[model samples]
Target: MERLNAFDIRELERLCPGGVKENVSLAAISRWQIGGTADVIVEPSSVAELCSLRAFIAQEGLPSVVIGDTSNLLFSDEGLRAVCIRLGSRMSSVHIENDIVHAQAGVWVPFLARKIMSAGLTGAEHTCGIPGTLGGLICMNGGSQRKGVGSSVVTVESVDTAGNICHRSVEQCEFSYRSSVYQNNSEVIASAKLSFLSGDKLKIRQEMLSILAERNRKFPRKLPNCGSVFKSNPAMYEKAGPPGAIIESLGFKGACCGGAQVSPHHANFIVNTGVARARDVLTLVSKISRCVLESVGHHIEPEFKFVSVHGEIMPVDEMLKGFFYE
Candidate 1:
């Protein structure tokens, strides 16, 4: 990784033209509201601008990270060393052509789902109330009620690690559970085309509203949380039921580590009660994982990516090491 200086902003301005914000608080952008600062936060207005920005970062040897909506992510309290790129609001348009819906990566999943429903399209109603952008949804293969977004995806257009634009169809995406091939590929999703069935607008709206109501009832709004913290492996829960049930049975509900607590409304969610640090959340998560493993002989994997410890962003490889090793 390389260090960035004031001079780099001049080059970034030339590449993006819209300018970038320096030393912006990551907490403002993240759902948890607990991250430190991002050295530079660039909101590129167009695909060309994004490409130019990537090229400039590579040429200048500046460390960079691209994030969308920041729903399933945890940033360090120490802060991030890399330049963070966020797609501009101008890139969030959703277009409907016949039965195909084309959505920009920056468009929120709920927004897109509403657009689809208003257009009398089905299949997307299940995504109602899901936080994050369309790109993050597809990248994470986000699902609800046993159905995932990948099932409706037809194609995706993204910028590869080398700054080359590429198109991948659903066949090439390799989506499973809460992950996709793009998870480790360093590719940034720009847009996606989804195929949906033509349906009654009134019925679609009703169904979507019902789903949202159910989600609100189950996950409530009393505390700040990133939905489910761990992925449920069926094999791990054969004797203990689902991960949530296992956690609930272990007397972990309302379990607190510092300011982080297991949400009483839902056992799977670890909420930031108030003034919670990244380490506090991690400590609680570790305690839950250990308790589950010790009591049920099963290790539950985390769904969200942990970006840092105290104030430092852990390397991606190092962050993933424990899951595979122990």
Candidate 2:
């Protein structure tokens, strides 16, 4: 990691007002609460500030990473050696204009869903229970198998690697199952305009409540977890069923490795039993993959977003290289 000189720090303070925090604990910023410190952390209050920070990182040739709410992510015990920018409460705003909702990327998706429902908006009710920021959800194409955030996205506003703002229509977003144009890009979403249908406010509220209730029953969030570990393979999903059922069929539910355990309530989830380390989770996931391959003869692919060992946030595909199981 390139060390931020005194001038860089001063400039950051000048732009953000809030001084840069050095050696910040990544664990404190994540949902799993189990990572080490990052070399540098910056809180950018708004999209303009984020753009400025991104440009500074580029000019200084420093590795930088953007995180939102940290729900679907898990950092390593080794921590991050790069600049980390978190869009704090300052950027979380929402506005309604006729049938469209304009929301900052930092807005909490579930909370935004409720606000939209209160405004008599439909089509995003399924997001009421999704615990991720709007940017994170849009980046991951987050939602149920049948419905997703992509359907409601009318336009996306993002900053490129050069810190230049660009807006793209829904047609240019390249949204697919669990992915979008930004999936592997060095860009950050600033805000998005989502189109919604007018609906009965009371009916929308009830639908959101029901969705939340169903998610609570099926996802088992009483303990810490990164949602499902794998996306159900299409062939198996149509034939044998989802990854959870395939895992349960092997009687691997309630399986444990140190403090990490496969959730008894949901076979696909590896929940923190109490104090699971990043290593423990990786160990259990590797064991599950091996067992499934040996018994079911189908290589189940994992759906992890972040799991780093070198103190850098890389794609899960590259980060899993050193592990015994691919």
Candidate 3:
């Protein structure tokens, strides 16, 4: 708290007004309902305000993070000491021009899917069941194997740390398997232009409904959880089917650590059974990775991220040994 005052967080409030918040609980923002309080949270209601806030953070050399729907993220028990920027409803909008659908960063992927369905767009049906923001979906290349969200992207609009806006073509988006240029974490995704094919409205709606049903069957929705615990690499799947197959083969489905439990419905999902802490999930992930590696000679990488004890956002594989609490 003292550190916040020293950094003059009030100055940010002066700039953003009704947008800057202090001592925010991360649990409230994330899907898993985990983590402690953040030092500051900024919700930029518009793109201009978002750019201003990003500029401020950059000029101050302050630690900061941006959040979307937070379906794929987990925060540490220590919480975030950095300023966290969030895109609110005001920033979310979906517009269709012919066969192109334009959406802001804050638009939910599922919502976008529905909007596309209404517009008779076919390319984004696979995104209907993926829980994330348009920004996060593009950043993580999030979507199903049959049709990832990356393919629909035609152009990307972004704000850099210097507060300069830039646009990138689909080729420059550098989309690959579960990865994209946005992974650099150096830009704030503002909006994206998605090109799609025309389809029968009824067909698009039916496909979206089918995908949602399949997702509901696979995901443990009753429990609090990040979508998938580990990224299912091609080689891993080639040798062991889906990531869930590997976990099931290793006899780890339904495994529990403290209040965190691996979903019996999906081995790739780790859910909070109640009273689960960041440490519990971290420990479980480490143990599972080690077990999978030893048993199959293949390293399983975590898909979800955790706020490290160092107060940095990091994947499970990158954390320093002994840096996490047992």
Instruction: Estimate, for each residue in 1-326, the C-alpha lDDT of model 1 and write its tens digit.
Output: 34476688788877777658888887777788778887777877777777777777777766667778888888988777887877637579889999999888889888889999889999988899899888889988997987889999999998875667889999899999887888877777888999999999999999998998999888847777788888889787676687778899999998888888888888999888877877787777777877787888887888887665232333333564564311
Off by over 4 Å in 2: 2-5, 307-312
In TM-score terms, candidate 1 sits at 0.93
Which lDDT tens digits does candidate 2 get at residues 286-313?
Answer: 7777787787677777766674533355
lDDT of 1 at 242: 79
Q: Pick the candidate with the highest TM-score.
A: 3
lDDT of each: 0.80, 0.80, 0.81
Candidates' TM-scores?
0.93, 0.93, 0.94
lDDT of 3 by residue, 1-326 (tens): 13467446777877677888777777777788889888887777777887888888788777777777878788888888777877656678888999998899998888888888898878888888887889888888888845568888899998888778989999998998778887775788999999999999998888888888888877889989998888877787888777788888889899898989889888989999888888888888888888888888788888876664334666667863565545
Report the backbone clash tally of model 3.
0
Q: Candidates 2 and 3: which is better by lDDT? A: 3
Off by over 4 Å in 3: 309-311, 323-326
